[model samples]
Target: MMLCNESRKEAAGLTPFLTPRKTIRLATWNIRTMYEAGRTAQVAKEMKHYNTCLLGLSETRWLQTGQLRLTTGETLFTKKSKIKLNIIQCYAPTNDTDDEKKDAFYQQLPAVLDKAGKKYMAILMGDFNAKIGADNTGYNEVMGTQGLGYINENGERFADLCSLNQLVIGGSIFPHKRIHKATWRSPDHVTENQIDHICISKKFRRAWKDVKVMRGTDISSDHHLLMTAVRLHLKKFKNTTNMRTRYNVSVLKTKEVRTAFHLSLSNRFQPLQDQIENNDTNIETQWKLEARKEKKVVLNTSRTRAAKAKAQEDYTATDKEVKKNIRKDKRDHINNLAKQAEEAAGQGNLR
Candidate 1:
């Protein structure tokens, strides 16, 4: 939380590069509790300015109940190769009552992947907060020989669910690289580690190469944001991928499902104005006609609603881009300082 009277600067860092095959690259970070207003502004700057196609942000500390809002707001998700494809940011409760929280996480997670359709290839990465179960990754502690290692107990379960569902764990951390382990560096230094994990599905693996982590840049926060990049497998025919698969029209798709209701309303009301004008003996039926008009009015209102929604998204993107450029300028300034210091060190030695 930041004070209303306080001043803060955005400070988000990211490394960007073009892939060999022209696929887009994406990265993930937990970013601690995003309730820190100052940091969230920075996260938006890095996420957007880097042109990240996918960002799995967790511990956003943003309660759906409106405890906070991302600098980019709820509608950052848009169409057009999903110019903005951000997923749910979660902070699964770690208390004693977290037993079935994994169930809740899975319940929510699959829907996103499903809505993402078959070919979009999501870059799902975040602070899973999952501890490796019992003596596996160099730590040797057991809860009862059964190895009930838990932190993201349910969060870990969800990560496994992602794997079982065919997602791939990317980076030096996980079943793939499985080296240079130990990401969660606790002050008390408990060996139970690797809570911050980066994962993606098989549909997105071949795109991820040379995945690595940022060793040390001690700012603050209990967990270091796991850093990894993936060159999104850009298909040759990418246009008709996510937006229009025949499978999209199903028992699911609540958003598109509303179209049926909308069309019905439109059919009933739009011609009513002419119907009333053409009929002379229908005055007694005014209530019925007005009811039909109401339905059409409601449906027609959606046209304006969609326009505003798109406009808002455009505005948020513009603001985010401006702020990100400013942060990049600041980072360049710091890099210049380090170079000057190194040059001075070299000159002093020459003397």
Candidate 2:
């Protein structure tokens, strides 16, 4: 019931320490059943021998779904990340299973795919109990012409599911001998079929370099080990030095700091007063100038006391307005930075 990853030391867990751009071998096998004594150890030994980074298992026959760590240092049921590789391990109902159950299985699968999202490279693989044969007539987009046997009822359903999700059947795409293509052999060892499969999302179809049945592997099971070579490169880390600085604007809430900040602004304005009196500038520049030039012009040209007094009043109002605008701009900038920081945190980019 639980999908597992079997690997060597350092590679024993799932995606925690996977090297970027490295070729990882992923596989799926219906070990028929994993109830026998030391069956897990036997599978892990063959997995290490094949250098498989992650292996999806079917028919584990475990009573519950949860993490299980073996004494051999192998962990089961973990996740992957970044330009993430989402692997869904399945052990579908057989062809004889009721139609309602098969329909439910196919319906629930899309929900899982939706949870994974379209942005990731998803690999859906396992013992599907379906046989999509060599004829890629109607299901040309999702399969190839190199499959093992003729299409069955389960095959039609499987092919339709792959086409709906835009998944490419990896086992059917490459030219391999019938022995390499077949994933399951009958108990009598007389009949063989490629029921087990590994499928990759069509968008990342190129990442799947190759897929074939590893018949040499021995696990005392009827199913052969179906392995795929996948090239995965996680997105590189961004440089922290180039990130924007988050200023401490909380100090502005203190009266002393506000007064000091205003005092500093007033002192800085003293030097620009003369320049403003001599030049015509933009709106922002005029605001910074505090209408000093307009005041000076009125004083020099107007002879009436009433006109001079009115001009003086206008200049005082303009100065207050400029200070108010400056305060508003500062508050807006701080709020914008806080919003950005919240968004970054949500995206798991605290830096």
Candidate 3:
């Protein structure tokens, strides 16, 4: 959505709200498993319906964790920033899972949390499969008594992890109807629990406005979509060189426009030409002066035309090169993932 000068002018009629850099609508959804036919498309279509800017996914069941580029010119899991806002998506094993496997999952969380930019925002969210009960206890700063089920072993560990990492459990902090708070429902329609969660860095606690489980979307999954409204003002540095003022020279190509331009120039120069003829009466000198004036006009017009052409050419070339490099990066990223998957499979470790 970053536009050059040419495209900006062409799209000047667009509303200001259409600007790409603005408040983001972020959501986290454990889509169960996007292995079903047309599942990715279904998720993408729902994302569009919600006008989501960033969406964290879990249990994607992708062969290997890697970046992907959508056909709509957006990249997933490939953003880089100096002081970026990070979102760590996860899918924890259930309470019945082996202790060793669960320990391994928590063991890896520190690395992910630490990988985020220290000075920026970080959101830890996903289907943790840990039920945090309706008791805040000593963790008043990180959670609330609004949680659903009773605290289990996994919930204690999850709360401890949040306490250690200075993260606030977003879901527990907001008071909602029990139905709205519950993230997952059993197939029997009798058991409802808040296993899925969205957490934000405690440092940015004020930025997180609300968190709720949405049930309107029928994504064919027991888990509901958890959305959080986090106020973030994205700072954009304008490239001054790309902010040049340009005129619509193509308008001059029209017959009526050309006639108008010529008539205006004629009216201006005719008076000067008459004055020169009356005062100097030197034909050659008057001709030279008029030629100089006309030459100045042509040079000014030509320079503008040339500048416009050069800008467009540069934009086109840069765009082409960018697309080409992006395709290469996608290929390389996927290849690396494939290689990692093969290595993991060879070692009998495919998690």
Best-fitting candidate, measured by TM-score?
Answer: 2
* Each prediction's whole-model lDDT (CA): 0.49, 0.80, 0.73
Task: Choose the strongest candidate by lDDT.
Answer: 2
lDDT of 2 by residue, 27-139 (tens): 99888777898888898788788888778988887776545677765666433322134788898999999999999999998888878787878889999999999999988
Model 3 lDDT per residue over 217-240, tens place? 678988888888767544668876
TM-score of each: 0.44, 0.61, 0.58
Please write out the lDDT profile of model 1 over residues 209-323, one tens digit for every residue.
6444443423256655455555555657656556644655464468676788687778557546654665532333454445445544555555677866765565555555555
Arranged by lDDT with the best first, the candidates are: 2, 3, 1
Q: Looking at model 1, report the run of 10 residues with the lowest lDDT sum.
A: 2-11
Between candidates 1 and 3, the one scoring higher on lDDT is: 3
lDDT at 130, model 3: 89
Error of 1 at 186 (Å): 1.7
Model 2 accuracy (lDDT, Cα): 0.80
Better of 2 and 3 by lDDT: 2
Q: When superposed on Cα atoms, how far off is each prediction in RMSD?
A: 35.6, 18.0, 30.9
